[model samples]
Target: MNTETNILNILGEQIKLGERKEVNFDVANLHTASAINVPIIIERSKKPGPTVLFTAGIHGDEVNGVEIVRQLIAKGINKPKSGTVICMPIINIFGFINLKREFPDGRDLNRVFPGSKNGSLASRVAHKLITEIVPHADYIIDFHTGSSGRFNAPQLRIVKHNQQLRGLAKVFGAPFVLYSKNLNKSFRTVCNKLGKPLLLFEGGKSFHIDNIVTNTGVNGAKRILFYLGMLSSKFKVSTPKKDCVFIEESKWIRAKLSGMFKASVKINAKVEKGDLLGNITDPYGKMNYFVKADYSGYIINVNESPVVYQGDALFHITKKLIR
Candidate 1:
């Protein structure tokens, strides 16, 4: 992976060693006929090393992930010490403009990986990204967040039994490491098929930017670069507050009935069997149903919406842990 080529050809532009360039990843025009050009910020060091790609905003509403990548660029963190660093702070500009998750045509961009050039609008963009940008990255870190109202604790999601990813995730030092299967046609799956090592980060929630989540993401990126000998000396990497908990299996706790929901337990908290997690109550205070833990485990996600209907997910708890 570390061939250390002097020139990198990406998106029809050649970036030489030690050169900094911002390339436009043009896909399609907006409804107003304005050209949509997603900026790809590339920074190369005079010394050669592995190329790292930091991407966010695959789902436009995941602002926390975008903020993390933005801070990397704004603080010159993308300026590597050795190798190259590419930052695509926002991928879905259409959905970003509308403050939505999917593309303007209502297609989930993540579901159309290794896309066809002559397919739908989202597919074209995905195809361009896979063909033009992704091939150049030696390591990829795609940031994301929980969908809907569920807030995910800062975590790195990797497939089970990948020793390489396990080591990398440990070095990244997030609060949690979740072993999950890759979704079909997901970016991670396509990258894996192409033999690129990618780390999928999940934290916070859509449309919300929490400072802690942002810092965790940024710090994790720095740690990864440092481990790869790409991070500049100016940045100081901090050790995680706690050892990352490796969750092997997890389950969602759902609401039994419709009501005003309030969580008494915080996210990432450990709970015992039958512990009071929260309560679901009728608006008129006629009926208050106490929500308790069915099994003891760490709460990885908590639904924050005030109102919830029957069968709405209330919490994500770990079912099993890996020692």
Candidate 2:
């Protein structure tokens, strides 16, 4: 083997600077008496710089983020100018293959961070990510989408008090930025505890890909890399045409009655209180229940699925723009 290949032995895999290398992370599969190897891509730069990690498919059905990472790799993003870019296009491989949101064990991987080695499937996967993958990065981007049947306006969801993370969110240049509260056992919460800068990108919807959402994610990622001084001028970072609007609070409009939902307003539409957002009708179209906004804000997420149950989240509204 050559010198570079010899180095691969040290890293347990052969990878070269400016070239894409695939690493299969082994996770135990008890039922099959085998191991599930999650695929990871690492692209290193010849010059030294900070390492940034881009992860997608935390919810396996969210395909737009996965596509964003794939496009980045295909478009020569694998060749960084000064730093390492580690992309895990599909982190929830089991869930991705099953087209489900959670692991086969019915556990949400995002909620079980810094997990135990001998825990459940989700916990084990989380353990591997926190231990083997996340520690090597200076910053992290966890990509997501609205849950299945819902669509979100491309936005960055960050903590309300972290100025550093807030700055990074602006650099991401998403049209809408939400200062969201951290959830228990979430990746965001763990990162915050570790004092790592981790930003969550939410857009599009699960099980499908939208061009606009994918473009926003891809461009936003490039902008972040440029801001971090990882990409040189040759990469051509584009400036945002408009300023990002920040919202500190958001509320979800829920269905009053179970029925067939038909949305009248789309994602990113500005609305006033009592505005006609959508209507829920019975199966035979005999009864119609008009759903109205409870607050004056922008629509960041809307349910696209036709069927909904009573109390089901139908629309997500953010507070009026501050800027």
Candidate 3:
């Protein structure tokens, strides 16, 4: 193809063969009376191959994903062995600026996919992603973390019966691979409808960067690129020390009473049925309520915040099986 016919991104920036370009998606903001431009980094290889997309910061407070993309760029994603690598480090700029999970309109960006151009702010952003970005990707990796007050072990979540996507999830090499039903109107569901293979990574806690989780995400991305032939096989990336645990069922352990919570176990800890996971106590230490596991499972997530209300989720447990 001629240089004049090179791929042009949403901002009308030309991404020629073997070239790396940073494009901006400018969305006019009426509420702020300003224009908000979201940054996107695109790297194209001279050789033809699959187009992979990496998106993070959908919840704004999910900083580990953003850092992973940033580190990948710093390590030179501009040069690839084959295909294109598109990185949208921060998708929810409004939420990111405010250090929150949802948009200023109180809408969760992840819950509104394939949105309309003339819809609400969250919808518009989602529309831009589905139209401008999703169409270009053969595979996608969406990065995330436990929402505020929670910590998740580095893991990958996928649909229960997608064997193809499940294989890729294993190759990404997180400690755990969770199979669950997709939430309605989520990015994953939209992409699945479009026949795109996408995987979601959950790790660390919102607003805080955990080194272990961040490193796992960075290495996992590199491993994925290597598997896709976009990176050389000789590329050195850390592999999971143990085989990824596949969990088909997971449940959240909620607080039974309102009080201060003290967790006895951390993420990735193994516990038997009725094991003590944590405890809730009054401010004066007069009353104590022990929280125990309902079944034997691995602790995938733990609430880090001390304060808790009745029915607040404090632990996310995935069923464990005996080999």
Candidate 4:
């Protein structure tokens, strides 16, 4: 072990690998009638060690994760170090351009896992990703943010069944952790089945940059690199609150009345059963309707936009029914 460490140190000191300017993993024709291929490459290290894959913009509008990946790539490139970083800063170029959640053909890239060779554009992207990259990753970090009309506190999303995922979640150093059992057909789901654990970090509601939440995410990924022995200590990391709620079941509370919304509760606020969450008021300022929680829990995500109609998802509350 000592000899290996010394060798790593020597190799690290002597390391010199230039970052690739372009790597074509798959071919695509641009809108200008020119043939182009999507680029994906690993910035390799001189020292042989673990390789981590950082991906973002699976849903183009979710910008924080992309920023996190881009920032890390820049850091790795500017300072050569141990291990390797394989990055794909923009995964969904179509959605990125359109600023939509789904692909150009309206396919959710997250749902099309281990995708087909001869399928839609989303499927082809997924297929190329899984085939060319994931198999080589020792650890994975995929970034995500809340979608349209929803706001989420910076948190880690992990499946309840996997302890490896849980361990990785702690490395993130976030205040909350959401147990999303609905990983079916998702990128993390397929990877878990293949024995490659991934941490799906979520924060900063869609289309908006929540500075506090984003910084938490940006710092969390950098902290993980240190914890994984991939980088030397360069900054002081805060002691993350381990007092996270283990929510096994998270459900959306629907608005019963059709009217403009008045959100009375904020994200991360705890509420008891039957507690008044907020209310809906008609445009005329009369005919007010009260919305209440069916179970006691904390508010992780809430509808930010005020104008809402009947059956609009108002709150995403998570109950600690199971540990």
lDDT pick, better of 1 and 3: 1
- lDDT at residue 5 of model 4 (Cα atoms): 25
lDDT of 2 by residue, 164-218 (tens): 9888988999999988788998887887787778989999999989999998998
Q: Which of 1 and 2 is ahead in lDDT?
A: 1
- Order the candidates by TM-score, highest first — what do you get? 1, 3, 2, 4
Q: What are the TM-scores, per candidate, against the unseen true structure?
A: 0.99, 0.92, 0.93, 0.86
Query: Which pairs of residues clash in candidate 3, taking residues 3 or more apart in a chain or in different chains?
Result: none
The per-residue C-alpha lDDT of model 3 at residue 147 equals: 84
lDDT per residue (tens digit) for residues 1-323 in model 3: 11223564545667877788888866656466877777898888887778888999999889988988888888875356888888999999888888999999999998998888999889999998899888878889999998867999999999877889888988899988988788999999999999999999999988898899988888888988988878854468677798889988789999989999999997899899999999999999799999999999999999999899999999999974312
Distance from true position, residue 300, model 4, in Å? 0.5
Q: List the residue pairs that clash in candidate 4.
A: none
Tell me which of candidates 2 and 3 scores higher on lDDT: 3
User: On lDDT, who's better, 3 or 4?
Assistant: 3
Ranking, lDDT, top scorer first: 1, 3, 2, 4
Q: By lDDT, who's the top model here? A: 1
Q: Can you tell me which runs of candidate 2 are displaced by over 4 Å? A: 1-20, 29-37
Superior by TM-score: candidate 1 or candidate 2? 1
1-323: candidate 1 lDDT, tens digit per residue:
95468999888899999999999988888889998778999999999899999999999899999999999999999999899999999998888989999998899999999889999989998998899988888999999999898999999999999999999999999999999999999999999999999999999999999998999999999999999988899899899999889999999999999999999999889999999999999989899999999999999999999999999999999999987
Kindly report which residue pairs in candidate 2 clash with one another.
Answer: none
State each candidate's clash count. 0, 0, 0, 0
Give the lDDT of residue 262 in candidate 2: 97
